[model samples]
Target: MVADVNVFVGQQRFLRLIDEETWATVPAVDPVWVDVPVTDYTVRNRPKRRNGQARTGSYQRRYGANPSGHPSGNLVTPLYGFVNEDLEISLAQLMMEWGFADHEVKFPRSKTAEWQYVGHDNDQRHLGLRVNTATLAGSEAGIVLTLELIGQSSVSFTGAASPPADRNKLVEFLFEDSTFTLGGTPLRVSQFQWSVQRNLDVIYHNSHNPISMPKTQFSETFSITPMKSNKTYDDLRDAFGMPELAGQLVLKGLHNGTGDTGNFTVLTIDFDRLSLIDSDESGGTGAIMNPLTFDVLKPDTADNGSAMTWTEAA
Candidate 1:
């Protein structure tokens, strides 16, 4: 038996991050793209099915007699990738998606109403999914980024149309400039993580797609470490009513040159103010650091703000 020529191999399928200007319509040319070293990703369009069962004479369930109607459900996708010393170019998209105050995309996502631009004007078919949540974490083992997009049913079945021309390989964490600070003081920790999530409410209007998907609210969480020292217990023995502090995390790569931009990656996040939400002592085979979690909030000291500075240099 001959194999099908169109059968896809695992390695043949790749992912490219498309910076959509309007809804999910992928541009035909000059599309702003991000090269990602994605470990895994999936595109799912789930249909909410309806069953028509009738008992004319007896009771028997059959799998037929369905209406030729459209069913709508959530169209979702989750993209996962590994972060390295030589991080990929996905930083730009991630920064904008995370909605940094000054860097957020302000253009009309819905050219007309809330969801009118579901590739409708362009004659292309796509769902109105938007990225609502994302997470970035790093530890001794590795670094990872997880992004989730969710919205109403799609107008068409589609995935990444084409793979990026360059597939960057993962560079092990090495020769890097990384630091974590709280209240302008360094903290010794084992691991760290941060997440940004938008509270989206989708409005459906008896169709396969939504009329609007608006973000009602949003939140940001930061975990600077599993502190090796019992700074909490050592000082006060109390957890609640602790003082708030400003924090920062800087992750940078080796210096290739004075003004070079492509050889090293840079990420600097400044939290205007942070309050400790949770802290737990831990024991492990690795560093026995205290795992700490914080709720990132807007600054209260003179009304400062949070900011994220980034550079993509893979």
Candidate 2:
């Protein structure tokens, strides 16, 4: 028999985050386009053996036996994505589930939102998923969102038979457009990546299915390449030497419409506040580049406000 040609595309795949633990609620918006190759999934099973005694023809002998295995397993799935937008609603929800705080911001001509890290000394972070939403349009508005959901029961799939087109396709239809700014000064960027991870604990009680839930501590890592400078390099060098001196790092991404004059949509991804605890200053074989790593943290100015921000404007 021939394999079905209904391959899962970027558009067919959707990601959502919710506050409730039942895995029941689904967001109204469509999921942001995610790179499936990077998203990983796994299932582990535990098996037991049996031993028995048997009688031989001449003398009694001990023998080994095999028995049917029981259902003892855990499930794990990790998702990764690169969003070019100013804000990701699902990420805000995930931040909250992981003990972070989310804040809404209003700008003179923009709509903005922020997520702040607010866990005490140490707490395990959490994440969940669901999918539905309008396809993303325009040139530079997206935010990377990663989530991990675990359940003891079997897998479940729900969606319409004829879903929407490939979201990646729509993204490609538009032109290449994005702007990166750091501390109000436009910075040249060679590459950038956003990563988030969450894990759940699985416990087996006196039942066939296992119980799994998210852990307490979850965080993000922002990696990018910035030009080497005397002051900047000295700051990073000093921070690495003195962990306590590493201050907050800020970065932003602004997305405008496709060159068309009629289009008026604009989006911004702002990482106004983060912990700059790590840095790498390597004189590359070809071009010497200074790569920076930012560990997201709570805003130093306020306890309830946000450290990272996103904005969408007409």
Choose the strongest candidate by TM-score. Answer: 1
Candidate 1 collision pairs: 226-290, 227-290
| Model 2 lDDT at residue 44 | 19
List residue ranges in candidate 2 displaced over 4 A.
1-21, 24-149, 156-160, 165-169, 172-176, 229-231, 239-267, 300-314
**Which stretches of candidate 1 lie above 4 Å from their native place?**
1-7, 27-30, 33-35, 52-127, 151-165, 168-177, 233-239, 253-262, 284-287, 300-305, 311-314
lDDT against the true structure, each candidate: 0.51, 0.35
lDDT of candidate 2 over 55-99, digit per residue (tens): 466464466543322222211122112232434432222232232
Name the TM-score of candidate 1.
Answer: 0.69
Residue 267 CA displacement from its true place in model 2, Å: 4.8
Model 1, 52-137: lDDT tens per residue?
57676757665553222222222122222223224343333343343333223322132110112122331223244465666766
TM-score per model over all chains = 0.69, 0.48
